[model samples]
Target: MGIDACTSRPFRGSEAVARGEVSWGRLAGPAFRPLLTDVYVGSSAEVDTATWVRAVALWGRGAGVVAGPLAARAWEAECPWEERELIMPTSRRETSDEIDVRRDRLLPDEVCFRYGVAVTSPARTAFDLARRGPLVEAVAAVDAVAFRCGLTSAHLLAVAAAHPGARGSVQVRRVVALMDPRAESLMETRLRLVFILRGVPAPVPQYEVRVRDGGLRWLDLAWPRVPAGRRKLGLEYDGPEHRTITGQNRDLLRDADLDDQEWEILHIGAVQVFDERRADQLAARVMRRLNPDP
Candidate 1:
């Protein structure tokens, strides 16, 4: 029964510890720190470059790398993301050889880096996707790049210029022209998109809405919908950006004004529109308010 000094049991993860690891990242638990949510073992260290490539192969585009959505989540960014799921970009001539999945291949204008942990280079991600990404998603990504990641429209434009003959070059230039780096945040941009998608007429962003005797209130999404019967509906996107006491008070006053004027108002958010369970319900509400059944 002498202790075998040379053959100490290698730390094959103990059963209890394995269970402990599994319990991290629960909805409300202190230990709950999500690694890959459904199919990844938690490794405190960033996924080494080799493992990152393997994960890309097995999980395709949904897998969260250390620098993927995890980075945004850890930083607590203001954009709408619930399950650490961030959309990954792929190359025009994407290849599954170097990395397991076909990452949106970088166009000639797209910039990239080797952070050792895989990530879209800020310049590359913002510029390359200026035209291709969903309007809302692109705005958020640009926010992440410019505000959170410290890139600018000029930087993105430079990247686009780098690849004169690349796919989407012209469109990227156009989008850059339209993008406003000074936009308050990604959520604000999505608010603008909500109006576009819901067929609410385009808004004058940062427009001031005022009553004759009142001060100005900046609108998130303002649209003039329908002129029949002296009625109209104005919409706004109330994302988490303005969930504070001050913001709540401001909106309350705005609501009071619209109520007095008989101007219908609509409020939308990522959860109200993007949540699978309630998207239809929200759509119905919008339709009912905008086009009532007589």
Candidate 2:
């Protein structure tokens, strides 16, 4: 297992390209040694690897995959949108052998890397991990490979046809058609997963609601789950950055509209999101709203 640069924690699947064959040696400047574990720092030839792409792929792991931008960048594939995180591939599928020592595990539906190590055909890669990735990132990768890198959606569609019933294939097709890479955010994806893991019905994300005074308002999550014919919300993650003085007033007015609509909102702040009491607070509120008795 190689250590992640960010966490320094040992990851499960990192494999050095040539066991101990390469190291920070013979550099003209600073003196350094390999860390007690795996990572090395402070040498200019410091980063002796080919590139970030090769470093990650040539030795990536579980939390690491042929990741989105890195994957495209590896082949000098042009990118259509900026990226949020590096995408890594898993070595689960048999294709790991076919994908090059550094590629990812993929379903026949989601990916297709050549012997040359270029990205897989578009539809295949998208279908493979579109749902797993933050949605926008997923779409951006698709755009990077398709519109920018010259792989076409029609070609990807044909690939999907060959892998019928691939878990995320159909959704991948929809995203291919509707993903507006121009206006998507990674935060929305995290919130969606939060709700999913909490067992709350998914919200209509980025829904625009008009205020009584004619200003436009966008919601992080719009309660789409109808219970007793009302869109009552069980909880809300209210980070302070968005709840500053100006933000507070807007939220107050928005809450008024939501309250009028019979929705109960539980505001969760950054502290609450990470605090010890968060789980208890969220559970109590969600249950209180979902099944109440006088």
Candidate 3:
């Protein structure tokens, strides 16, 4: 028999078989992909993070709130969807390589719903992510989520105050101090953090420079103030998208405009922000420019 026509969402294998939608053999075939033990989605189903969240919710019979990175992604944060995380109130024997199940109870206000699955609220999601990973990465994750969810430093701090004894609360507080909602991308946040961690004065995120034609040009990061004869410094994170010919041409035009306005622009790439040695070098270069020899 052909696979079930309802391939848009996940369904139980037994139910598909019993409903005469798909045979047991067909269900076991490549036509369907297993999510949990019995949970399956059609092989062609466009399974995204939300799909996985819903599948796990079904597997657990809706017993837990989806938290951590998965929850951040569900809230539109630019987080990696490597694993699905579920916070359960009680322990369970079943476990899957695809899911990270944590046993913890959540306050009523901490839980919310997204894409029809229970998830931690933005504040709680920020709280969890801001406290879990490397300091720079944690701050970047929180920045993306905060910007997407319209959260401010105060919103994150309020959550931290409520969970004073929470693991990584100190990290969360530090993240709050560094998080900038104006950050437009993950790499941008990392670039900013590199300078901050290297002891270079923190450059403003998304700094705007007024152009010749009464238009405003925003730099990825900028220091508006500088000593006499030293142009204002602007730093840009040039991701892969900026490597294309058209993108390069556009950047040239923009850079020319900024140059005419006496703004010095430095373009940074992934290596400059990710590679530790290179990151230090990049920061050192910026320091020289910002603090030229007197």
TM-score of each: 0.45, 0.43, 0.93
Model 2 ranges off by over 4 Å: 1-187, 194-199, 224-231, 234-236, 243-246, 256-263, 270-277, 280-284, 290-294
Candidate 1: clashing pairs of residues: 25-32, 25-33, 89-104, 90-103, 90-104, 90-105, 91-103, 91-104, 91-105
> How well does candidate 3 score on lDDT at residue 83?
63
User: Model 2 over residues 115-228: C-alpha lDDT tens digits?
Assistant: 223344455444443544555456545554554445666666666677677667656776566433222333444444444446655556556666566666566556645556
lDDT of 1 by residue, 107-221 (tens): 4333223333344555665654565545566566565556666667788877767667776676676566555554456766665545455665455555456654576555554
lDDT of 3 by residue, 102-134 (tens): 886577888999989899999999888888778
Distance from true location, Cα of 96 in model 1, Å: 18
Q: How does model 2 score by TM-score? A: 0.43
Where model 3 places Cα greater than 4 Å from the true spot, the runs are 1-6, 18-20
CA lDDT for candidate 1:
0.50
lDDT of 3 at 205: 95
Q: What are the per-model numbers of colliding residue pairs?
A: 9, 16, 0
Q: What stretches of model 1 exceed 4 Å from their correct place?
A: 1-125, 128-135, 143-162, 167-183, 198-200, 239-250, 280-294
**Alpha-carbon RMSD of each model:** 10.6, 10.8, 2.0
